[model samples]
Each structure stands twice: as structure tokens, then as C-alpha cells.
Target: MTADARDLARWSETLAGIARTGMAFTESLYERERYEEVLHVAGDIKAAARAAADEVEVEREVDHFVQEWMESIGEGVPGYVTPKVAIGAIVGNENSEILLVQRKDSGIWLYPTGWADIGYSPSEVAVKEVSEETGIECDVSRLLGVVDGQRMGFSRFGMYMLLFHCTATGGELNPHPLETGDVGWFSRDELPEATAGAAWWGSMAFAAIDGEQAPATFDPVRDAIWRTDDT
Candidate 1:
């Protein structure tokens, strides 16, 4: 009977983005007032999610989220709120092994990934992340998937992950001191028990590694776009 914490967070963020964008383009005083009210509601929703997730009583500081959203508002095109982008590499070697890194922050194993850098292309970010996090040099072969990180539980915030299929070119299994706890080649059957989002991406990744020609994957459209998980 209760909304999931993640669903609450998602709804709160979506509402906050809408309010911020409305504030950006509207000059009418009444519309501005309404948008501000929406921001307050969004803040309440976010605070609720935080409380639920932490399993503790949270002080409902609606003003904090409102101020944060208000500060992020920009003029015109830049005001359009969108999910952040991250790039991931599914690097495969000649032995049909995938390169995975144990994230230092979470201790979960996943393909090498990082936030998209300002100057580099998406594919370039994937290559850079692989080399930096796992010390694996790889050439991108093709795109594997474009995944919604929130839906897949890879991130709490809205993020789009550009997953690329890559072939290992060189380098040894040297994990980054700060970013990765460990790094190594793993066969499909040998993935770590703590592998993140394996159900959502495992098949696609291993198929790519095994030389299967499949189109890039994405989340399918929901029948009710705005419906909550409980519905």
C-alpha cells in the first residue's frame, strides 16, 4: 500500500524539473506562483522518499529542495531539465571474457563506467573509463544498449547509460587505486555474486561478447507512462 522509495524519488524529481522549467519560461506572476507551489510539493515528496529509504524520521525541509531547484533554473534552452548521461564499456577479450570492475564506492562489480566528460564523445568516455578504472585498453566495436539507470537501480537519480561493446586491445588487470577495488576478466558463467543490474544487461553483454549481431537495446515504453509501480 506504500509507494516505493525509488518511485517517490523519481516522481519528485520529475515534478521538480517541470516546475523549474516552468519558472524559466514564464513571465506571468500567477504562473510563477503556481510553479513555486509545485516545487514545494516536489520537495515534500523527496523528503518522504528520504525518510522511507533511511527508515528514519526526516525533517521535512521543503525549502531546501525548492531552493536547490530554483538555483538550477537557466534561461531558454539550458533550462530544459534532462537526465545526466553516463558511458559504459562492455569490453571483451579473445577468450570471450568480459572486463568488470569492482566499484570502490559500492563494492559491486559492473562494467567500467563513468560520467560523460565535457569534451569527449560518448564512445570516448567509455574507452577512457575502461582504461582508467580497469586498466583495459579497448576499441569500441558497437553500441550495446542505452539504459535508464534509475529503472535498472544502478543509480538513485535519473541517468542514461550509453553501453558500448568493445574489444580488448591491450593492458593488464590493474585497477585504479581510488575508483576500483579490483578489476579482471570474467567469463559469462563466472560473474561475481554482487554484479549490478545483471538481469537487465547480462544477456546483451554476453551475446555481444559471443559475436551475436543484435541491435542496441533500450527500455520499452510502459503502457501507462506516468503510473507508479504499485499501479
Candidate 2:
């Protein structure tokens, strides 16, 4: 199906409205086969706007389009639609041993992390997750990186993850009931069989260890596999 320039302009304008309100666009609005159509329209609008030579107006429109596109179909809820936030922590001890948790539901060993709740910032979400999962009090230090866990299938609810470097402030390591079965500190060399998905372990660890500020979004399906310096 061919998308006309007018259609593109209209979609672009609609997207701008969506961005302004932070509204989620329902996937049900368009069938799966129509995704390509939408994408084509978006591209045409972008190209025409760019070719117009009105740089400022074009940029504004492009920014609006990008923001709206992200707000609508960026991440969370593959088929339906919703906003999701996730948090990950680089929790370590005085011995520099990083803490890991074995989740009860998935039986995956991952860093203490979970979805961001309604009333918390991303950092607060990380701290809350750490405390809830490991019974540890931690102070969020710095943002290690943000990763798109959606493509990697690490996110259960199609959420994006914000990873943080954290310091254990107090409290002992006590696994949360049912949510986590085990909690342990592992040295860099003595990592456990991670119950968390491979992508989470790989990306979170690399960002924390190397102190890299990765892109805010990474689609594992489109991006290359996570690789360490040696790899």
C-alpha cells in the first residue's frame, strides 16, 4: 500500500498530539499488516519535511513525530498498549562482590530489579526493588545505562529498563517471600548460573563494570548481541 504525502502529514500531526499528552496509542487501532503502512507514511512525511528546506519547522515536526511514535508504540505491551518502567541495580558489597537474586516466578538469577511503581522515580524503583527482593537497603548512585529489554524478552510486560549503580547502605540480604528464592553475593570471577535472562545479565553487568552510558533504548532484535571488551 502506498502512503500519500497528505496522509503522512496528517499522521505526523496526530503523532504530535499523542506526544504532547503522553498517551499510548492502541495497537488495535491498526492491524499487524498495517504497521508497514504507518511506517511508510511516517517516512514519507519525514522525507518531504526534510526536503522542504524549512529546517526549523521540519525539525519541530520531526521531533514531534519521533516523540509521538515513541509514546505510542515504543515499548510495553506487544499487541495491546501500555506504559512500562523497569529498574535494575548494580548492588555490591565492601568486598566488591555483586549481589544477585534468583526469582521464584522465572527461576532466573538476575540483579535485584523490577517494574517501577506509580509513585517512584526510576532510581527509587531500583532501590525499592533491591529492598523488596533482597531485603537490602541501597542508595542509588548513578545511572549505569538504559537498555531496551523488550527485544531481549527480559521484560515480562514489554517494559524498558533503567539500570543504576548502587551502594548497599544497610540491611541484610534476605530473600523476599516467593518473589525471590535465593540471594547471594558473587565475585566477578565466580558468577552463578544466572536465572535472569541472558540479555539482562550481559548488558547490566557490562554497563556497570565498564561504566558505559549506553543508549536509552536498545532493541536486541535489531541490535547486535551484548559483548564484553574481551568478546
Candidate 3:
């Protein structure tokens, strides 16, 4: 089918999902072969739509991604593939400062966040991520928001970010040596540099921190959410 950018992205993501599930669940060699072929076609879809300047390079990159994804495949019961859940904390201190961490790899400042462990509840995960990333003990108050990571362009795969509002209980400023570069509490007026989505999140975050009585924030419905050009 002829495709636009949104169509390409949708096709790529859908086929990738099928390919990954096939890798994890299918024991049949023929099925695996078919899925791998789908992976190649899905990868090339993006290049075909836009990155077509050098098709060969795009193919190489897509192959690399498929290989990496294959390497990271976690074994599961044959056919239960689904989106993963991540947890984040928007911790606020008594002073009304929000807890922030600079990621070691990206150098971007954001609320403390991590993948949710199997045994932990969402609130528990929130508190744990805050403590582990920023050395800040916290108590989760309530769910702040939930975002579709892929839809938000924060992830290539299907995932959800469960963000919780929290109150800092204790602990000193100490960043995780491996996962975090720096960590601290910052008031809205004194936020650090390179904070991801600060323009979209700044006011809402601060409002939550400042004890505002409002509904939890969520991504608004769009006529075409996958399309970048919204008018």
C-alpha cells in the first residue's frame, strides 16, 4: 500500500511486534524464517518512506536493530507478548522542590524512573526508582499520569510509563554512579538544563508538586495521534 510517514511508522511498529512475538514464541523454523523476513520488510518501510537517500545504509541500520532486539529477547510462554510497564516518580519535598536526575547515557534531566519489577506494585516501584536513582526516600501519594511511550515518541516499542506523585521522606543528594550522572531537588524557577519535555510538563508537574487539586494529567486525544503535523 502507498504510505505516509504515519503509515510507515505504524507499519514498522506493527510488523516489529509480530516479528518479536514470533521470535519469542515460535519454535517452528519456518515461522521464524517468515518473521525474520517481516522484520526486514518492516525495517525497510521507514527508509522507503523518508530515509531513502541511501537505502543500503538504512538496511544496515535496520538489520542492526533486529539483531540487537533478537539478542535482548526474553523467553516467555509461547504467545503472550505485550507492552512493558515503566514507573516514574515526581517527588516533591516539603520545600516544594521536585526531584530530578541526570541520566548517565543521555545527559537529560528528568524525574527518577525505572522499569517496574515483577514483585513491586506501581507505588513501590515509584518509591524504589526515586531512592535508587537519586538516593531520595519517598512516599508515593497517587498516580500522576500514565503515558504510552511509543505513542509519545519516547520509545520504539510498545511500553507505558506510570508516573506517580510522591513526597520526599528523607535521604541526601547522591546520584547512582552507573545510572545517573547528577541528582538534586529543584524548584520550578530553578530547573536544570536539558530537561526532557519540560515545556509540556513543567507547569503540570509544578502544580502537582505545589498541592494543586486537579485531575491527573494525560495525553489529550488527537484526531491523528501518530502524525507529527497536527493542525
Tell how far residue 230 is off in model 1, in angstroms: 4.8
The lowest-lDDT stretch of 10 consecutive residues in candidate 1 is: 53-62
Best by TM-score: 1
TM-scores for every candidate against the unseen true structure: 0.91, 0.55, 0.81
TM-score of 1: 0.91
lDDT of each: 0.87, 0.62, 0.78
Regions of candidate 3 where Cα sits further than 4 Å from its true position: 1-10, 22-33, 46-56, 69-79, 220-231
lDDT of 1 by residue, 1-231 (tens): 134787888888899889888888888999999999999999898888878877545564667778988999997778888899999899999999999999888899999989999999999998899989987788999998898887766576779999999999998889999989999889999999999878878898889999999888899998876787558
Task: List, in order, the clash count of every candidate structure.
Answer: 0, 4, 0
Q: Where is model 3 poorest over a 10-residue stretch in terms of lDDT? A: 47-56
lDDT of 1: 0.87
Badly placed stretches (over 4 Å) of model 1 are: 1-3, 54-56
Which of candidates 1 and 3 reaches a greater TM-score? 1
The superposed Cα distance between candidate 2 and the true structure at residue 95, in angstroms, equals: 0.9
